[model samples]
Target: MMTRIKYRFLPFLLVIILFVSTLTAPVSYSVQEPIMPDSEEARKILEDSLSIVEIDHEIERITARQQELEVTQRQLRERITVLEERIDERRDRADAVLRAYYMGERDHLLVMLLSAQSLSGFFRILDFYDMIIQNDQQVLQSYNQQYRELQASRASAERNAAELAQVKDSLLQQRERVLALQQQVDGALNTSGNPEAMRALIHEFTLYWENVGLYEVKRHFQALASAMENLPGFIQGSKNILSTNGKVYTINIHEDDLNGFLRSEDKLFETFAFRFEDGKVIASGESGNLSLLIEGRYSVVDEPQNAIMFEVERLVFNRLELPDTTRRSLQDEFDMNFYPKQLISFLKATEVSSSDQRLIVRMELDL
Candidate 1:
């Protein structure tokens, strides 16, 4: 009996050990990978993103135009009010002149000329009467001309107001059309029945593009700064002066030649630095005038020269790279036919300040 019980207990113990071993064994499962920006799916997504950005900008422009039209309309109304007041005043003046002349004065002038005491006095009185009549005629003519001008101005103002109203209506229609396009883009992106997901991806892409583009731009500036460091160093106790407008300006003195002029010790840039975001480029830095002057060894006595506002924006635009298809999509979507035009639009959208020896640049663009 004891031996049978031991064998039965051993089998139960073996079964329990087998179940524990199964639990301890590692299990493998598959996970979905993130979609790469270079993938075809990403390309389609980017296209949609581009359309969205374009539509957003279009809406902004249309809204601005509408506001501008409203401003014009208000101005026209104000002008009409002023003209109406002037017309009323002019009419009253003309009425007064007509009443005074017709009711009071023709016989009086004749009587005064007849009462002259001498031949010379009589001639002088006659000339004065003639001049008075001529002046009255001129006043009437001036009133008539002013009335005509008022009528013309009123007509022009009315026409302009009407045109502006029509233009505003057209802008509203355009805004609707833009909204329709945005809806279409939404529809396309939501084909997977998860618009939120698509939007999330777009958001991610925006962040990714901004980060990558910023990195690249920062790198470019770093490279430029490094290259600029090789420029001729300012010597200690040297009179580093620049001249413009026939006035000489002294450069700030530094301890050693390695502390180059023009913001050399500033991180990643001596002349300028930049960042990209939101389809705009902002640049703020010291002008390259000092570098050019120093490089060329230009003389102060030569001529009064204007400070050259550096075209650093051109460099920022040129250095930026996007796939050819992406560029074409930008052109079609935003009507940005040229890279420089796109850069300009972006710059207009961004705010920048580059005064008092500091450089700051911020640029934005659709990736």
Candidate 2:
């Protein structure tokens, strides 16, 4: 009879347990269904992103051309300098010869020709005069050639400078275009149907890019990976000033320490970055067209044991907060728990607080 009574009470106990859990669980339930984005908004997002990419490419091209222009300007400056020096030297030489030619035109050459004693002498004087004229013509031609070359170089330098200015203007214009596209992207995302559906789609796209591992993102990870490989290793390395002298030992970990480790540690989280504000963590990551922001808090879990744990307070994807239902579905992938096993052999964390630049964790021996 006692056994039958115990079995009958089992169902009642289970119902009570579930009801209590429902009351205690975090309240993130949305009364309305998540908005579902239709085709128009989706198309706008794609168009804006692609336009931004094209603008970026154009900016790169303009920058390269500017550099080329700068180099050409330098070469032209040197050329102009050499030409000016040569022209000055030629001008001096031509001045003296030109005066002699001018004097011959008046009467000096005619007097010499009239004083010739014989036919052969007269022929020699005439031929000598012709030679003097020819020589003067050659000198004048050379001087003019140098001046023309110098002018051409100066003109080229001016044109190149103008082109560089135009290139800079083009770059600025391209910047405006990119900014416009960004605004369009924001507007489209904001007005899209069903924020939750947008989040789900963003999540999927982020996961896809993470798995595929774009070259730039991979390079970013590789750079950080050489310094820190995992979260534990990163946490352990942050023991710059270990406080082992007292009963309580402490270590300060900054936002970047965790961000670098997380990004370099997992390719999925390669785009994630962390920021600390008012003792809360504002972590964000970008995957393809969507950006993921997770705001969380660290606290000592009270019920089962005093263990340091991070709880996600809000999850936003592409500027839209995921419904509790959506977060519950996706939060596992963003799960983070601090394990300071290597950091402290047996000390237990009692409190976690934040300051201006870092999160300070206070640990005391369990005994």
Candidate 3:
């Protein structure tokens, strides 16, 4: 009976030990973290960031240059003002001399000569009149010289002022470009960093153009269009474009009012207003329009609410023809502007025909 009772107690003791061990044991838990963007997309975003920094550097350089030009202009203006005052003073002196010569000074000399008691006195009086006339002639000559210098200085100042105005215009354009590029980069970071968002953008870009019988080589037009809103009024014209081809192209503005866009990049268009004859595309040097033609074109599609499209059929990345520094900068800009989120603002601002047929843009570059 005692043995049976001990066996029943053992079972109870084992249950109590198990419960104590369970309370003393350590507990652990884990959380799953979301995946970041792929290396390629991250690299692209980094590249855009670097490009923006470089563009900012260029803008700073341009701003410094503009400031220097303004200082020069101010100095020129001050020089002209000083010269004008000198000319006026010299003229007044010359006029006084002329008045003295014309106001019976000769008569006064003759009367003094007649009143002289000795011949030597009369001779001395004649000499004094001659000296006075000589001094007047010298003063007139000096005044004429000063007048000529004043005119030359005025002309120079005017030229300098005109140059300063040009520089000012350029500064404004570059600032706008910087803002547009910055906007594009930010949009890319938000969209490209997300795999789903990027896929959706690619799908929409492809679907819209494919429905209209055009196949885009790449989906970058959205990126370029996104920047247009931050752009100045003139650059806003490069909106609502759909590229069928794969290459990148340059945009040329024919309107004079729109010239600020072209000039913003340092008069790259020169004086020639490049016209795209419906199906042509081209790219030119940043220095001037006539330096070299990389061959590009742009066109407007009237069917989709005046969509302006730029297509580069043959794009040559890192052209050896361009300088090393320029080549790198161009590559940076090309890469930065070719992303999906870039220039989307310009596309959205378009006046589309229907809700289903909203504006689409694709800007692709081989960088």
TM-score of each predicted structure versus truth: 0.40, 0.41, 0.38
Global lDDT for candidate 3?
0.50
lDDT comparison, 2 vs 3, better candidate: 2
lDDT of 1 by residue, 172-260 (tens): 76566657656766667767556677777777655544544334344444544454433323322345421123222223222133234
C-alpha lDDT values of all predictions: 0.48, 0.67, 0.50
Best by TM-score: 2
Name the candidate that leads on lDDT: 2
Clashing pairs in 2: 35-194, 36-193, 36-194
Question: In candidate 3, what residue range of length 10 has the lowest lDDT sum?
Answer: 212-221
Candidate 2 local accuracy as lDDT?
0.67
Which residue runs of candidate 1 sit more than 4 Å off their true CA positions? 1-45, 95-117, 127-131, 134-138, 141-145, 193-197, 204-367
Instruction: Give a tens-digit lDDT track for model 3, residues 211-321.
Output: 321111112222233333344343445553333343543332333333344445433245323333334434333321112334333444444433443444433221212
